[model samples]
Target: MALLTVKNLSVGYHTRKGFLKSVQGVSFSLDQGKSLGLVGESGCGKTTIGMALMGLLPDNASVTDGMILFEDQDLLKMSKKEIRQVRWKKVAMIFQAAMNALNPVHRVSEQISEAILAHDADISEKAAMKQVESLFDLVGIPQDRMRDYPHHYSGGMKQRAIIAMALACHPSLIIADEPTTALDVIVQDQILSAIKDFQNKLKISVIFISHDIAVVADVCDNIGIMFAGQLVEYGRIEEVFDAPMHPYTKSLLASYLTLDKDVVQLNSYIGETFDLINSTTGCRFCERCSVAEATCSLVAPEWVEISPTHKALCYQCK
Candidate 1:
C-alpha cells in the first residue's frame, strides 16, 4: 500500500473579502522510500498543501473536503489528540524557516533531545543525548557543536539541525517545506545531498515542497505541478521535465534558466493573478494559458492520461 494518499483535498482561508479557496481537489500518493515534489509559483497554494498535510494550518484556514490517508488510516477522520500522537512518532515536518523554528535560547542538543524524550518517555536523558549526537553525525554536524545555541550555527547548519530533529523519532515520513530556502547555492546542494543520502539510508518517504523547479528536480522521484490551487500536472521527474503536457508546466521550464541552454531565453506568463475569492467555473489558468481556446474559458479540463503513470489537466490532451 502507498505510505501516504491524499484524495480530493480542498482547503481554504477565511479572509475579510471572503473564503479564499487555496487548494482545490488536489490528490497524490507516495510509496515508502520514495519522494514527491510539489512545485509551483508563489500564492499557488503549494505551502498551504504542505501545511494541510502536516495538520498545521492556521486558525483562518481549514480542510473543506478530502481525505488524507497515511498507512491506510484516515488522518482527516482522526481526532486532534489522535493526530498529535501520530505526528512526530509516525510523521514529522522540517519547516521552511529552520532558524525561526529552532529555539533561539536553547542549545541545539537540548532541543533535539527534548523531541526524543517527549515521544519516548522511557528513554533516559543520556540515551536521548546519544541519539542526538548520532543524528548530528548523520547530518554531518560535528558532535561537539551540538551544545551550541541556534544563533551559533550558520544557515546551512541550522537547516541540518532541523533535519536531525525531524529524524529524532525515526518517523516513516517527512514533509520538508523549502528546507533549503534562503541558503547559498553551495549550501543548498550540500543540504539536498545530505537529505538524499539520509532518505536512502533510512528508507523514508518524503514530501519535498519547493517553488524552485530545479531544486525539486534534483531530489524528487515524482513531480506534481500546482497552479491556482490545483494540481495541473503530475508524472515522473524525467517525464514531466522532458515532455510537459500542461502549458503551465511548460512555462515553468521555459522560465528556468539552465546552464546547458546556449541561448538566453526568458519567458513570463502574461495575465492577471489567480482569482481565489471569486473563482471561475472553468479552468483556473484559462486567462493566462497561451494555448487556451474559447472552450477553456467555458469548461474545466479533466485529467488526461499521457502514459499509465503520467497525466495532465488539459482539454487539448484529452
Candidate 2:
C-alpha cells in the first residue's frame, strides 16, 4: 500500500461573500522512501493541501469532501485525539518560515527535546536530550551550538534546526512546505542537499511543496502540477519535464530561466488569476491557455494518458 493517499480531496474557506473552494478533486499517492513535489503559483492551493494533510486547517476552513489516508487509515475520519497521536510520531511537517516557527526564548535543543517529550511523555529529560544531540549531528548542527538561540543561528542553520525537530520522532512521512523559500541560492542548495540526504538515509516519504519548478525537479522523483486548486498534470519528473502534455506545464517550463538553457526572452502566461469563488464549469486553465479550444470553456477536461506513467487533465491531450 502507498504511504499516503489523498483522493478527491476538496477544501474550502468561509468568507464574507460565500464559501470559497480552495482545493477541489485533488488525488495522488506516495510510496515509502519516495518524494512528490506539488508545484504551482502562490495561491493555487499548494500549502492548503499540506495543511489539510496535517489537520492544521483553521476554524473558517475545512475538508468538505474526500479522504487523506496515511498508511491505509483515513486521517479525515480520525478523532482529534487520534490524529494528535499520529501528528508528529507518524507524520511530521517542516513548516514554512523556520525562523518564525522556533520560539525565541528557548534554546534550539530545548525546543527539539520538548517535541520528543510531548509525544513520549514517559521518557526522561536526559534521554530526550541525548536524542536531541544525535538529531543535531544528523542535521549537521554542532553539539556545542545546541543551546544557541534561534537568532544565533544563520538562516540555513535555523532551517536545519527545524528539520532536526521534525525528525525527532522519526516520522514515516515528512511534509516540507516552501522549506527553502527565503534563503540565498547557496544556502538553498545546502538545505536541499541536506533534505535529500536525510530522505535517502532514513528512507522516509516526503511531500515537498514549492513554487519553483527547477527546485522541485531537482529533489522530487514525481511531480504534480497544480492550477486553480486542481492537479493539472502528474507523472515522473523526467517524463513531465522532458515531454509535458499540459499547456500550463509547457508555459511554466518556457517561463523558467535556467542556467543550462540558452538565453531567450522570458515568456509570460497572459491571464488573470483563477477565480475560486465562482469557478468555471470547464478547464481552469482555459482562459490562460495559448491553444485552448471552444469546448475548453464549456466542459471540464478529464485525465488523459500521455504515457504509461504520465497523465494530464487536458482535452488537447485526449
Candidate 3:
C-alpha cells in the first residue's frame, strides 16, 4: 500500500471577491522508503498541497475537495482530534524556513522533547531527552549544544535542529517544504545529504517540495510538475528528466545547467504571476503556453499517460 495518496485534492482561499482555488485536482502517491519531488514556480500550489496534507492551512484556506490518504486511511475524513494524533507521530513536516520554525526562547533540546512527549505519553522526561540527544546526533548536531536556544545556533544548525524535532517521533512520512531554501549551496548539500541518510536508515517516505529542480532531481525517485494550481506532469525522475513530454517540464529542464554546459535561458512562458481568482474555465496555463491552440482557451485539458509511468495534462500530448 502507498504510504501517502492524495487524490483530486483542491485547496482554496476565501477572498473578498470569492473563493480562489490555489491547488486544483492535485493527485499523487508515495510509497514506503521512497521520495517524491513536488516542483513548480512560486505560487503554483506546491506549498499549499503540503499544508493541506498536514491540515495546516490558514483559517481562510481549506481543502474543499479530495482525499489525503495515509496508509489507506483518509486524513481529510479524520476528526480534528484524530488528525492531531497523526500529525507529529505519523506525518512530520520540515517547514521552509527552519530558523523561523524553531522557537527562539526555548532550548533546542526542549523543543525536540516537546514533540516527542506530545506524541508518546508513556515516554518520560528522561527518555524524551535521550531521544532528543539521539536525534541531534543523527542529524550531526553536537551534543554539547543541545541546551542552546535557537538564537545560539547558526543557520545550518538551526535547520538541523528543526529536522531533529521533526524526526523525534520517527514518523512514517516526512514532508520537507524547501528545507534548504535560504542556505548556501554547500549547506544545502549537507542538509539534503543528511535527510537522505536519515530516510535510508529509517526506511521513511519523503515528499520533498522545492522550486529548485536540480535539488529535487538529485534526491527524488519520482517527480511531479505543477503549474498554476494543477499537476502538469508526473513520472519516474529519470524518465521525466531524460525525456520530458510536457512543454512546462521541458522548459524547466532546459533551465538547469548540467556538467560542462553553458547556462541556457529559461523559457518564460508564464507572465509575472497567474491569477487564480479570475481563473474559472479553460486551461489555467493557456495564456502562458507557447503551443496553446484555440481549443486550449475553450476547455480544460485532461491528464493522459504518454508512457508506462509518465503522464501529462495537455491536449498536444494526447
Candidate 4:
C-alpha cells in the first residue's frame, strides 16, 4: 500500500476580491522510504501542497476538495487535537526558514528535546536529550555544540538542526520545504547529501518542495511538475526529464542550466500569467504554452499518459 496518497486535492485562500485557488485537482502517491519532489515556478502552488499535507495551512486557506490519505487514513477528516497528536509523531515538517523555526532563547538541543517529550510523554528528559545528541550526530553536528544557541550555528547548521528536530519524533514521513533556501552552493550540496544519507539510513519517506529543478532532480526519486495550481506532469525523474510531455515541463528544463548540456538553451514563455483568483474552465496554462492548440483556450486539457509511469496534462501532447 502507498504510504501517502493525495487524490483530487483542491485548496484555496479567501481574499478580499475572491478565492485564490492555490492548488487544484493534484493527485500523487508515495511509497514508504521513497522521496517525491514537487517543482515549479513561483506562485505555482508547490508549497501550498506541502502545507496542506502537513495540516498547517493558514487561516485564510481552505481545502475545497480532496482526500489527503496518509496510511489509508484521511488527514483532512482528523480534528485539531487528532492532528496535533499525529503531527510530530507520524509526520514532521522541516520548514523553509531555519532561523525562524528555531527559538533564539533556548539551546538547540533543548528545543529538539521538547519536541521529543511532547510526542512521547513517558520518555525521560535525560533520555530525550540523549536522543537529541544522537540526532545531532546523524545530521553531522558536533555533540559538544548541542547546548549551543541558534546564533552560534551557520546557515547550514541551522538547516541541519531543523532536520534533526523533524527526525527527533521518528516520524514515518518528513515534508521539506525549500530547505536550502539561503545557503550557498557548497552548503546546499552538503544539505542535500545529508538528506539523502539519512533518508537511506533511516528509510523515511520525504516530500521535497522546491523551485530549483536541479536540487529536486538531485534528491528525489520521483518528480511532479506543477503549474498554475495544477499538476502538469508527473513521473520518475528520468521518465519526465528524458521525455517531458508538457510544454511547461519542457520550458522548465530549457530555463535550467545542467552540466550535461554544452550549449545552454533557454525558452521564454511569453504570455499573461494565469490569475489564481479567478476560476478557469479551459486550460489554465493555455495562454502561456508555446504549442497550445486553437481549442486549448476554450477546452480543458486532460492527462495524457505517455507510459505507465509517465503522464502530462495537455491535449496537444495527447
For model 1, the superposed segments whose C-alpha errors exceed 4 Å read: none
Each model's TM-score, in the order given?
A: 0.98, 0.98, 0.97, 0.97
lDDT, candidate 4, equals 0.91
Candidate 1's residue-wise lDDT over 218-306, tens digit each? 99999999999999999999999999999999989989987888656588768788989999889888898888999898898899999
Candidate 4 lDDT over residue span 6-125, tens digit each: 999999999998999989999999999999999988998989998888899999999999999998999999999998888979999888755678999999999999999999989999
| Worst 10-residue lDDT window, candidate 3 | 263-272
Which 10-residue window in model 1 sums to the lowest lDDT?
262-271
Residue clash pairs of candidate 2: none
Residue pair clashes in candidate 4: none
Clashing pairs in 1: none
Q: Whole-model Cα lDDT per candidate?
A: 0.92, 0.93, 0.90, 0.91
Question: Positional deviation of 94 in candidate 4, in angstroms?
Answer: 1.0
Best by lDDT: 2
- Model 2 alpha-carbon drift over 4 Å, by segment: none
Which one wins by TM-score: 3 or 4?
4
Q: Give the runs in model 3 whose Cα sits over 4 Å from its true position.
A: 264-266
